[model samples]
Target: MSISVVILAAGQGTRMKSTTPKVLHEISGKSMLFHAIDAAKKISDDITVVLYHQAARIQESIEAHYSGIHFHMQDAVQFPGTGGAMKGVHVTHSKALILNGDMPLVTMNALESLMQGDADINMSVIKLDNPSGYGRVVISEGSVVEIVEEKDCKPEQKEIQTVNAGVYCVKKELLESYIPALSNDNAQKEYYLTDIIKMAVDEGKPVHPVIVEEEEFKGVNSKLDLAHAEEILQRRIKTEWMKAGVSMRLPETIYIDSRATFEGECMLENGVSIQGASHIIASHIKTHSVIEDAYIQNSDVGPMGRIRPNTKLINTHIGNFVEVKKSTLTGVKAGHLAYIGDATVEEGSNIGAGVITCNYDGKNKYQTNIGKNVFVGSDTQLVAPVTIEDDVIIAAGSTINKNVAQGELAISRAPMKTIKGFFYKFFGEK
Candidate 1:
């Protein structure tokens, strides 16, 4: 009762107009092939990826991330067609589920339904408003008889709306027997996998067709198709997050990565983008904030905050126009106009307005360590290779180049002097 999955990822995706392979093109921050592969993994781990056209590069890109994947290269010598690709695969199970890598929106429920059907062959089919170039499903006596490609169909057959979705669950033995029988006599002169549908009917194998929503089979073949698919995916993501008690003031204005996780009641204001596998918990992110690869908990950040990778915040408040990169802030409040980079601020520190940690020194970046209850005053510049220990107070407008010890007051500024009536003297108004 085992099943093998064959992912058809060999197409060059010529319509995408990029040097990168079409399956490599992303939707919602994940590659199209990965979306298909992830779903297939949920069903079965024995996946054979049929590769062609930049096959090595595709293999290299995904091999490290996805283990136990069998790659079969479809090259010129193989006469690399879909049917030709299947003929060479070494499937271990009696049943094989074939899927196209381009279709990302195919649900696991539909696939499982196909698996659970009591038939020798089951393929997912969708009824489109305009079938156009898709192969139409010919039906008779309350069941699917065969699939007719648009090029091979008559004028009446061309009017059928139910089209082949390129998703199939077939018996491996039956598939192997007829794969060589597929002919290449069409105008395109390619051995199509669709011909097997007719072959199965002729062989008296029960063909079960599972109808799905048209959007579930939306394939990404071009840049326009990619965008359309992205909209569908984003809408799905937003709806799921919303259902999980995360609030977005304007959902359409956000572009959140699919891998990002959120916990507790969080409020995301307009124009807030959270990307790259970040985690959030009970936080309020204000408008126009960009956070990538960071972790936040019970923190409030910006109407315009830019938090970069590897930053961790806890019980912190980072205000407007502040940018923090590669820093860990715990119980810190840096309200408005600051940049804290490559620094670690311990609990109960107040980083005042217009403060910056000068972490870079031309050759390499250095770290600034600030201990508990340290008060960094306004307009202060903390030069790198420095530390302000516990209960230290950095005076306003000072540029500290050296470290300050515990409970000490550090200031590096020239003495203030008065120049009376300087404006009158310069203007010659006497």
Candidate 2:
């Protein structure tokens, strides 16, 4: 059966105490709402996101990343609450999987389980030792009879250990029929989506409770909860990479972005961070190095090096304190203290320590190209719009602005003078 997805993201999230919308907060480098949408995409593409607080901003952000998403605006004045978020929304499938946007850890497997039973309403529930803050799910004869919110629960109902997991899969027709008639008679003075359970039970419709793991349903409401969720997602990402033949010295200290992927036995040392869609193929990243949005293959990057965006390294060795940005190095070795930006160093090239590519000249950026078998000595500066041809040699401490032809030597140092007593004369020494 085809199922549509409805993600409720209209809440103010006042507990989060930020100008940013709650659903926009990130977990493992992705917003919580996007995570919910991602899981929903795994099941169906007919997805609708309901928004109220900062609706325009949220819509704009989401539209930049996704297409064909149906956005619904909730009427906060006339209709308010989870049930109100679905007001006037249409579903294209037989069933609609309603999800809370704050639950970033919700997975596709857990959602697939909700589609198992043949019931009018499939509600997710988890048994907790202390279910204080959540609504209680009252079950009778293996079916959910009612859902009592925490504020209105009686003393006996308060002790119910089975709590609503805030996720539901309901028949499209039932949602269309019941949501319009929901009453706001509760203590919260809002139309509760949980009221649909009692409505279904009153008519003797089957409402099955699907028990799910607590970790997958964790909701992020405050800064503390966001941190906790980040840790959980980080651990999950690292564990999956390690299982896929990637090795890490201290897994806890290494941070990997969710969008990053590795292939064919890569290794990372302690304090290494890889971010922003980096792809590593059989490379070894040493301690304290950071790589961002770069492709590295069969290379060794420093004990303290940084590879910035748009860089590609193949069989290269970038040593300590080296930073490469927007450049490609092939079979090259830059062992220490160099910055190579907006440049390309071809095969069999050696970039000595303290070398820099003066690519930016305070107005516009330019490129520096070094051909095969080129040797750039220590403290050499290759100015922008310069090229060193094949088999060219650059002397130490030279600043070259002009291109060097093939098999030529380029040097720009001033000629030494024989000022024997210059130091003593300058210092006024005897």
lDDT of 1 by residue, 1-430 (tens): 3789999999878999999999999888788888888888888978989998899989987896799999988754545578767766778898899988998877787678778756878878888888898878987765689887788999999889988877888888878788867777867677778778888888788888888777877789899999999889888888999999999998999878878899999999999999888899999999999999999999999999989999999999999999999999999999999999999999999999999999998999999999999999999999998988999999999999999999999988899998999999999896
Report residue 319 deviation for candidate 2 (angstroms): 0.7
Give per-model TM-scores: 0.95, 0.95
Model 1: how large is the Cα RMSD against the reference?
1.8
In order, candidate lDDTs are 0.88, 0.94
List all candidate RMSDs to the true structure.
1.8, 1.8
TM-score of 1: 0.95
Which lDDT value does model 2 have at 403? Answer: 92
Point to the candidate with the largest lDDT.
2
lDDT of 1 at 133: 81
Off by over 4 Å in 1: 428-430
Backbone clash numbers for all candidates listed: 0, 0
Pairs with backbone N, CA or C atoms under 3 Å apart (clashes), candidate 2 = none
C-alpha-based local distance difference test score of model 2: 0.94
